[model samples]
Target: MNLLNTLKICVIAFLFTSLLNTTTQAQITPVLTHDDALKMILASKKHAELSDVLVNIAIVDAGANLKAFIRMDDSYLGSIDVAIKKAKTARYFNIDTGKLGELTQPGGIIYNIEHSNGGLITFPGGVPIKNKNGKIIGAIGVSGGTIEQDKSIALAGAKSLLN
Candidate 1:
């Protein structure tokens, strides 16, 4: 009787585990790949004057590797570095670095995050790219324009993915 009971429990456990695995797989969302990031950037460019803007756009992977970067002619030399920094900041934080200033106030956890990441740029041009499930998988950064303009461009870029 004890052996039979043990067998029944094992079968029940197996069925329960199988059900959980199936549920988890059905709910899991795949992350955006590098190709997806590039397509989003291209779509955003159609809405803006890419050739006219003197700016740099950088796209980085979750690990902060540069997947795609573009610097228009006559853009500021420093904008490239700044754009990269912003992209890294977005990738690491999974949020816009523009909000870092507010989030890093005297009582905020992000306050010290700036000091932690040497290359993090707390500015308005960086936007985190999230998967359909809202998981951050990459980031894009723009520089060489006004902060507001940069933010607008970044938003345009991110919005392309969803819309």
Candidate 2:
């Protein structure tokens, strides 16, 4: 009789614990929306003279879905697609595509994944956005400016999230 009672209690405890685990796992990470992406790009325009270089900025969710994309007036036509690829690369690989190139080197494990995905760019202007727990939930990409300028804009966008 005691053994049966103990078994029943253990089973109940196990079921309760399983439910708690499921609940925790289902909690979605806070992700940036389309509005947030646009605000970041528009707000950063004042940081420097964007006249010479029209900027293209894009943001993608963790699943690599395009949340938003913006191209400044006079920006190059290709900048939009480039920015989207950059964002996809960052979000898919869970790291800045710029860093991936170096970290993966020729014949390296990550190197193999460089272009396998649908749309991924390894250029310098892409960056990943992480939550407080250090989990990447999205990415941002910037183009239309010089590589350095684009990188700066991407960094600024990420920093804007922090603030």
Overall local distance difference test of candidate 1: 0.77
* Per-prediction tally of clashes: 1, 0
Per residue, candidate 1 scores C-alpha lDDT tens digits across 1-163 of 6999999999999999999988875554356566667776675454447535667888887787888877777879999899888888888878887887578777886666677767578879998877656777778888888888777787787767665
**Segments in model 1 whose C-alpha atoms lie over 4 Å from true places:** 1-29, 50-52, 105-113
lDDT of 2 by residue, 7-73 (tens): 9999999999999877765553477666666766665554325435578888888898888877777
lDDT by candidate, in order shown = 0.77, 0.76
Score every model by TM-score: 0.71, 0.71
lDDT of 1 at 112: 62
Question: For all the candidates, what are their Cα RMSDs to the real structure?
Answer: 5.4, 5.8
Where does the lowest 10-residue lDDT sum fall in candidate 1?
A: 43-52
